[model samples]
Target: MGQSFFDEQRDQSLVKAAIVAKYFDAWSRVMIANAARGIRISRLAYIDLFAGPGRYKDGAKSTPLMVLERAIADEALSKLLVPMFNDADPENVASLQSCLDSLPGKERLKNAPLILCSEVGKDAESMFTRARNCPTFSFIDPFGYKGLSRGIIQSVIKNWGCDCVFFFNYSRINAGINNDSVRHHMDALFGSERISRMRAALIDQLPHEREVFVLEELAQALKELGAEYMLPFRFRRPDGSRTSHALVFVTKNPLGYRIMKDIMAGESSTEDQGVPSFEYSPADARCPLLFSLNRPLDTLAGELLSRFSGRTMSMKSIFESHHVGTPFIERNYKAVLGQMEVQGKIVANPPAQSRPMRKGERTFSEKTMVTFPSRAA
Candidate 1:
């Protein structure tokens, strides 16, 4: 028999909770900063449709409580906070309320004029429709995949400048997409009956490739909903046998994308010194996961070389063009540029200097000129 939905919550992964908390905290900081600069953002609303009992049996806080605490800690966010937590189970709703009532900093949150509520229901479409008017951050994390409908997601995003982070269980899709009942759900989730074509195309492909194709299809569907930028983080079972799911983020704002990329990179539990990557290990796993803080310098360097070979451009031009929402962050470009200089593949030029910079170190600024070397010398 399949695991019970409540049992799934009780057995939640710490790595997943950590990732979600880090991203939401970082995103909140970015939005608060933007508002401080007079961006006129009215409010920061957060809605979690499948919010579990706010705390798991293992004592780790779930996404709903984590987000609420992050907002309460930040004064700017606390003042503009409008949050709603919902679950299909009334018991879970009551548990969430108890968790909220017991949270620290009640005095501060009470003074902030927060608009918060918990509903005992599974009415995600109605809740999403109501969230369409503000600068919202919605979390749609459902076990398996039944509660999230594509039409509701599309309408919410198309109507406002909101951001969403949710899970796409391609493993479930791979198992069920061929079944008639499951195919009906897939069509509703993709907002199209064209999944038959996708299934036909993936029939002879490798398993991993089939997952990739499914993810691409999902990303494309999200793009059609007016999401200008989308990012996906793949997750696997603790044993690393097969991909369990992928966490996807969608937003129309470049800053939102940038912030999320940084958060994802930093929070990734990879030990490599070059590019940041993440892999999940269950709480009961034999081996503990290592968390590292490496930037994607190697990947960024290669991407820069590939895109700018034989071309000269200022740092401002390069950053504006590439760093707005890619895996290569602008802050890490200095390190990448330094590595490129060491390899003689590119030259970072100071203002008004045409000579290739071959010094002890080059500090990249907006005025710095970067040229991809054309000659071997």
Candidate 2:
């Protein structure tokens, strides 16, 4: 059967909208905080390469509109924001523009500039390249695996202070990779001839691992392109048996990586390790709730104990490391460390025993160092 129009695919799932909302809120807060820290005054840009018609048939807001909502909510952010929404469909472009015009604070956003472009191919490339000069958050969510070639992603990744949250169309790409007719498209998508070899390697693996293996390779490719942090959020079947697709976030900023990790963790089904799996079916009672904090500290505790066994480090040091994500912040880290100390797993400096005091005293501070008892003396 021929595929339905992209606009009509609204009934598919609401999981994507939830994810976009969480990330958009985080992006605005992070940018505002960064600006407050004297991080050079400049405009913030949001580009949605495959922007839809702002609203779905189910009356849900798409990526572009969600971003617009965030900007409008914060006056400071709205003033510094530059929104560029584009789609290949001219009908979509018109609809998106009309949607913006109808917004409550549409006049306020006018000064910040909202560029709606109806272009594809080179014209689209030119639009993206223009956003390269400033700090930009791009939502490169394409319907299929066609437009976002590796080269295009690389160009955006190379842009100064640019962070991308891309939709990796794993199922589509995996199904089409072996077909001779789709080889050129695959080459363009991956920006390499190594995909064939990569696919061959996956054939011997388990069904689930096949999806993960390809995504890991894609993450590694982006890393080679200079993404300091690469985090992938997996959206799998409700039973957690196979994969659907993944939202791959690539960035050069450590702080951005940390914030995004926390946001994804909050949205994940299991607070285990690595990329979290989430399903947002309204009728499915098994799906994780939207705002639940799924005990990420417990997950981080085991990893921290294992990785930092013998080392003595300050709470600040551990919190500032690249390894720390949304599961916990400085306060949570200190509390966990204190719990470990009480359990005789680690020793704390300025010893908790030294200060005989009230119950639930704050035991670990950024200055206080901790050493695991398991470490070599």
TM-scores for every candidate against the unseen true structure: 0.79, 0.79
Model 2 misplaced regions, further than 4 Å? 1-14, 33-39, 111-119, 142-147, 272-306, 322-336, 350-368
Candidate 2 lDDT, tens digit per residue, 248-348? 88888777777776666666655332334343232234644532455455666677777777788887787786254344445567777778878877778
- The alpha-carbon lDDT assigned to residue 341 of candidate 1 equals 75
Off by over 4 Å in 1: 1-12, 107-122, 142-147, 271-273, 278-303, 323-332, 351-367, 374-377
- Positional deviation of residue 162's Cα in model 1 after best superposition, in angstroms: 1.0
Q: What is the C-alpha RMSD of each candidate to the true structure, in Å?
A: 5.2, 4.8
Query: TM-score of model 1 relative to the true fold?
Result: 0.79
Cα lDDT of model 1 by residue, 239-315, tens digit: 65567777888887777777777777765545344455544435324543333334345578778777777889988
